[model samples]
Target: MTTPLPVFAEPWPEGVTHRYLTHVGATVDVTGGGDRTGYRCTGCIYGSSGQYWHENVAHERAQAHAEKCLALPRPTQ
Candidate 1:
C-alpha cells in the first residue's frame, strides 16, 4: 500500500496565522494582525504581489486560489 503523504509544516512568518487547505492538499497561508495582510500558496507560484489593506480581501484571494489550485502537497525529506 502507498503511504500517506506527510502534512506540510513550514514555519509561518511573523503575523501569518491562517492556513487554508486546497482541494488538492496544498495550502494557502494568510498573514494578518496588521494594517495589511496577504496570502501565499504553497502548491503554486501564485501569491500576493502586494499587501492587502483588508484582511477579508486576502482571505477571499486565498479561497479563490485554493479552489483552482490542483498541485499536490510537496514531498518532505
Candidate 2:
C-alpha cells in the first residue's frame, strides 16, 4: 500500500484554492490500508500542475490555511 501524502507541507498553490472536501472516519479497504483521520482538499486547481490531497492530513492543512487566512477572526494587535 502506498503511504498517504502529506497535505500541510505548504499552503495551496497560487491561483488555486480548496475547501473541506471530506471528513473520513477510517480508511476503507480500497486504499489497501488507510486511516482517513485527516482532512482532504478539493476545489479549483490553480494550474496544470495543481495537486489534490486525499490522504489523511487535514489537521496540518487546516492549521496552515488558518495562519494565512485573514478572513478568519484575528487577534487585535
Candidate 3:
C-alpha cells in the first residue's frame, strides 16, 4: 500500500492566497480574495467559522492558529 502524504506535502488548492505552516508541520490554507477570505487547517478542526470581509483579518486569524496548533496530519486511507 502507498503511504499517505503529509498535509504539508499536498498541493495548494486553486484560489489559495496563503499557506501557513503549523507548529506540527501541518498547513493552514487561506483562500478567497477581496471581501471574502477564510482559512482551513489541514491537521485540526480549527478554521474560520465564516469568510472574513478583509484579507488581513483572515490572514491574522490563520497565522495565529498556525502558531499555536500542534495537531499532526491524520492518516489517509
Candidate 1 stretches with Cα past 4 Å from truth are 1-14
Model 3 lDDT tens row, 1-77: 95554455456778788999876678788989767988889798888767465788888888988889989965565
Give the clashing residue pairs of candidate 2, or none: 39-58
Identify the leading candidate in terms of lDDT. Answer: 3
**Which candidate, 2 or 3, has the higher TM-score?**
3
What lDDT tens digits, residue by residue, belong to model 1 across residues 1-77? Answer: 95475575767556677988887788888876455888888777778877564787788888888888989866555
Q: How close is candidate 3 to the true structure, as a TM-score?
A: 0.76
Per-residue CA lDDT of model 2 for 31-58, tens digit only, reads 1113433332232111112233343444
Q: After superposition, how far is residue 10 of candidate 1 from its true place, in Å?
A: 8.5
Error of 2 at 65 (Å): 0.4
Better of 1 and 2 by TM-score: 1
The per-residue C-alpha lDDT of model 1 at residue 25 equals 80
**Candidate 2 Cα errors over 4 Å, as ranges:** 1-34, 38-56, 72-77
Ten-residue region with minimum lDDT total, candidate 3: 2-11
What is the alpha-carbon RMSD of candidate 2 to the true structure? 15.8
- Report, for every candidate in turn, its global Cα lDDT versus the true structure: 0.77, 0.31, 0.80
Provide the global lDDT of candidate 1 against the true structure. 0.77
